[model samples]
Target: MADIAGRAGVSLATVDRVINRRKGVKERTRQQVLEAALALGFLGADEMARFRDRREANIVFLLPAGTNPYLRDLGDHLRQRVALREEGSPKVRCFFIEGFNAPALAEAIRRNADWADGIAFFAIDHPAVREAVAEVAANGVRLVTVVSDLGHSGCDAYVGHENRSVGRTAGLLIGRFIAERQGAVALVAGSRHYRAHSEREAGFLSIQEEMFPHLRLVGMREGHDDSGQNYRHTIALLDQNPDLRGIYNVGGSSGGVARALAERGRSDVAFIGHGLTKDTRNALVEGVMDAVFHTDPETLIDRAIGAICQPERQVLPMKLEIVFRENLP
Candidate 1:
């Protein structure tokens, strides 16, 4: 108890009061104590009992499950929070749904409607999905979108990179690297079902057409964020466009692309894309990829937690990091 109090920066009596739900403790102080207990894993039976009696605040996080490091890292952070047990702690849960299946996602949301206090998720652009989110909002549950914006859908706030800006960064990097070469540039994405991928591709192309007119974008290929699809598509694209000089991964399968490039001795291509997962890191180190625009997944999780705790602490804008072999952090 003393160690918990020390870690929580509160007195033992205050900790006891919080654990036992004694009267007169401010909400802020109580929350701090509870969060400390959660982070430190020093929760007690009394805290568990008090948690059961409180109005269970549930925060459900929905994201597409795949091999993408960014998504995996975010999911891992959420899972850690869900593992914590503390009085009055918001019960955090995560759902890994199929790619942009609006009906399926909505059904999950609807089924948990009664208990959900807030929902933080990646935005899906389908009309049914928007309507479902609208239904949740109508029912008074706070909804937040991460890594993709759903501002038009009346979401509480978005916690991610500006998709267009992320794309422009990729464009500038690819364009600057290839210079005025007449070689074709390729864009591989997850799926058009995702707003982020589409927006990124649009932004990348907009810059390519306007500023780097000489750099031809061959076409945007959908990887569905799958390894096998990315590998197969990359091999075929390379074969079809032997003169392709640059590649940009708007989303997904960057690792698979690295493997394909390395196998075919095509590492000379200026590759730029998203995330800094283990595989992406390896690619950068081995010179198979030129650069990566990473939006920190841990920071996204922290922002989600902050929004849940203090809804007024305006969600911070996500940073689009430019990671090259020279500056691989």
Candidate 2:
């Protein structure tokens, strides 16, 4: 910082304000100081803030937008932790951006490259997104994939379940719930773009084929992680297949599925899916849905933050929680 102040021909206080993103630094001066820091391999306000040197740790969370239950849970828990600042806090700052628009997300990642010490994204598997992750890695940012994954992208750690195994578990759970019933079972997924959802569907199909040969997997509907669309498509499919005995939702839009089921007065169908949000808990208690494959998003975020703060420590692997009416906690 002394070197930066001297090199920029600015006072130490001026350099501090600009580098810390504190108010009162002129925009031009801020830019100049930032450019000087970048040029000199000096940390930005966000990175330096993580230090008791009053360093701020800027960690960006890139995820799909909308009323996504899982991301909402994750964001809420992380923010609560940020508020408490009681344990392992690192001058935290977060950015929530839409997970689609690969280029836009990539650009955001790149823009924060110098400012952020680490990044956790629900990665989309496009080349641009991978390249952006790579760029962050190259910039020496601690990188992690959360919820959905970017498996081959050289992420420092993944803070979600073994996706394929969880999917297989979802499949087996759904397969059994519909085994004695008649008619083909339908599956609704958040998006084919997400590795997690796809793996869940695969696990589901594998188990369904192996155990419930009588129950057919009719096909899958793509809901694009939108609640309205998930509801609409679920309703449409229910209408088309009156004999549809089951529905397995493998992503955050499980609430929409419950709504569609309730609207059609066919909550009798064995509807089971993922996530244990308030909606799913209510549905399970009312017997509207059978069960949910739950994950503790709060723990996921905590471990993620820990991984960022101490990359050398082995953050524990996430567990797949199965939530039933009797065990909805």
In order of appearance, the predictions have TM-scores of 0.80, 0.80
The lDDT leader among the candidates is 1
Worst 10-residue lDDT window for candidate 2 reads: 48-57
Q: Measured by TM-score, how close is model 1 to the native structure?
A: 0.80
Assess the local accuracy of residue 45 in candidate 1 as a C-alpha lDDT between 0 and 100: 61
Clashing pairs in 1: none
After TM-score superposition, the amount by which residue 323's alpha carbon in candidate 2 deviates from its true location, in angstroms, is 0.7
Cα error, candidate 2, residue 26 (Å): 32
Compose the digit string of candidate 1's lDDT tens values, residues 1-329. Answer: 78778887878988897787653344566777887787677776676556546565578888887777678877887777777757777788888887667788777766666666777888778787788887877655677888876658978778888898788888988899888777889989888778888888888988888899987678888888877788887898899999899999888658989989999999778998778888889999999999988877768876875675566777767777788889876
Per-residue C-alpha lDDT of model 2 across residues 1-329, encoded as one tens digit per residue: 98888778878998887766554343456567766776688965666444224344567666666677767777787777668874435656566777566787788778776666787777777888899887678545778887777778978888888877786776677667666876878889877778888888888888887878888677899887677988998888888887888888887768888888887888778887877888888789878889888778767777777777667788555877788888766
Candidate 2 global Cα RMSD: 7.5
Global lDDT of each model?
0.79, 0.76
